[model samples]
Target chain A: MNDQTLFSIFFSAMVVNNFTLALFLGLCPFMGVSARVETALRMGLANIFVLTLTSLAAWFLNTYVLENAPYLRIISFIIVVASLVQIVEMVVKKIAPVLFRQLGIFLPLMTTNCAIFGLAIFQTNRGYDFMQGIVFAIGAGLGLTLALVLMASIRETSELSDIPAIAKGTGLTLIIAGSLSLAFMGFAGLL
Target chain B: MRTTTPAEDFVRGIWKENPVLIQMLGLCPALAVTNTLKNALAMSAATFFVLTCSSVLISSVKSLIPKEVRISSYILVIATFVTLADMLLQAYAPVQHKELGAFIALIVVNCMILGRQEAFSSRNTVYRSLLDAIGVGIGFTIALVMMGGFREILGIGTLFDIPLFGPNFEPWVVMVLPAGGFLMLGFIILGLGVFEQRKKSREAAAA
Candidate 1:
């Protein structure tokens, strides 16, 4: 287990096995919110924050609480994530009103992002120690951010080009994502 | 607030309001496990089970759930059914279960199921909610199968593991990769768009 260094885990999650492009974890926001670079960056930041929190909660639960009752993992994770998002929403609203306004619906929607939940489950399954899990979460979050920003920037430019009617909207975005995924596949050689 | 008949509710989701294609509610599993037809079918079946069960349960108990905590309650109910689906798949089809992995658990967060509860089930009668859930479930299944069929046939020159192409056929290995899922769905949606556009123009010409 310790044979795998933290940097490798981080690198693998960020590029080699990106949560969005490769694993298909958080495609919702990847498609939905990638229309604007600014929104995508903010969404990515919120995701990283939430994902890190979820990793901590999941590690604590797996190590101490869920040792015997493995079946409760799914139910418990969902509840924890949902409440965590709620708390995050409240805290953000209280501390940074401007950022809260910008994040708006996406923050609440983060609870259902699947990427966060996927991270928690993946971390537990990998049996990473606390530090490793944190690094993994940050790496996955950055990967998602990278994919989102790249897609958003591309979409921003594509908005200017005259595209065929049939291939507009989601159809076009998905094809772009495919090409991006193919490009990211090149990163697999890094390891 | 026009009323929709039971038949309309049932038929609507299959095409017009398709949870996957039209509304784009559940794309995670649609893209993740669709590398093979078997995984697609299994994943769709699990989603269908959870969707229908949770819709029925939520609609029946709608009045009992307070508005303040309804979302949480709905999620809890959905999670329970998802848990059951996860265990059943693990026991009956361990191989596919292993292939699908975190996705089955992730189904609990599938916006499609929870979306149905919040949008339709919480207000509609139990019978209508049942119809809606089944319709949406079938719609979701159709999209996944379309994706699965396309990928499996092209990626491996087979359908359901049965060879369709001669040995000489060169498979487009990319079709089975993660990229293929996105490309196939993109093309599928584009095809639908063209079909819709042609239909509208023809209808205008006839008129």
Candidate 2:
């Protein structure tokens, strides 16, 4: 397989094919945790951390463990992701309680974020080697962070504006996300 | 938990507690695969199979799973069914399977399945869990089909690939794209909100 340059992979994942805006991988938290810019940034950092770890774990599993037993990919990936998040949560709680408090339930909830699983699966399917997979995860995590920060900042301002009764809450957030997705589509030519 | 009738358990998930429209659970597949009616139907069918089977299995085996590891156990059960569904689709409907891609496997992480297990099946009777799963599954299918129908008709001027408009009909290309999925669901949720408000006001006026 011809490997894509790390820069291209990073740039593509960050903007051209952003995980949240383009791929629809992690909309739950993209919507749920994006209400405030500060929280969103913290969540993004957590995502980046877990995603990088996931890349390492998934690569190890794919190259070493799952080569012969491909059917076990889904199950093993889920277990690995869940436990990894748990370990991260515990570590964060131990080392940085302030950040842990800010992350709160969202940290643990990352287990089902789908973006993590999507990243692992995509890396495997694309046959990304160790370095490529790690770069891709970092790029995706940054992409997600960018989307979250943008949405959260806009939402912070929108709170003062008069949204229609019908378009408040989730409806408004989703419409905004749709617009963001449209804007991101402009970057499709970058690759 | 308050006691409820079987009918209530089944009906609530369809409307009052709709996993997609009301609760906003499991949105990735709802938005990702609804670009076409066929893909949406296949995804929903696969979800229904996995959800129903896992809910039944989990409820039946709830006691054996210790509280500390119940979440893991539930995931294991759900992942098993998802794998089965994935393989079944691969063997039988390879085309649809390819269209669905990793989404079929991603079903293992779908919050709806895990939520139902933790919230309902783990506590409720097997019969009630079955009803709840069926109701939620049907609700999800309804939502996906509605979205798929809307997107397919506008994006491609067809429903299930049957041309609805004349050959001259122009398609709104965005309706089939990722942006369109978000916009469509946003509008749908908005419409539902308006409907709910009117119903509430009407009831207040009557009272």
**Whole-model lDDT values for every prediction:** 0.93, 0.93
Docking class of 2: high
Query: What clash pairs does model 1 have?
Result: none
lDDT tens digits, residues A108-181, model 1? 88888889989988887788999999999999999999999999999999999999978889999999999999
Q: Provide C-alpha RMSD values for all models, in order.
A: 1.1, 1.0
The TM-score values for the models, in the order shown, are 0.98, 0.98
DockQ for every prediction shown: 0.87, 0.83
The TM-score that candidate 2 achieves is 0.98
Worst 10 residues of 1 chain A by lDDT: A102-111
lDDT string, candidate 2, A87-132, tens digits: 9999999998988987777788788899999999899888999999
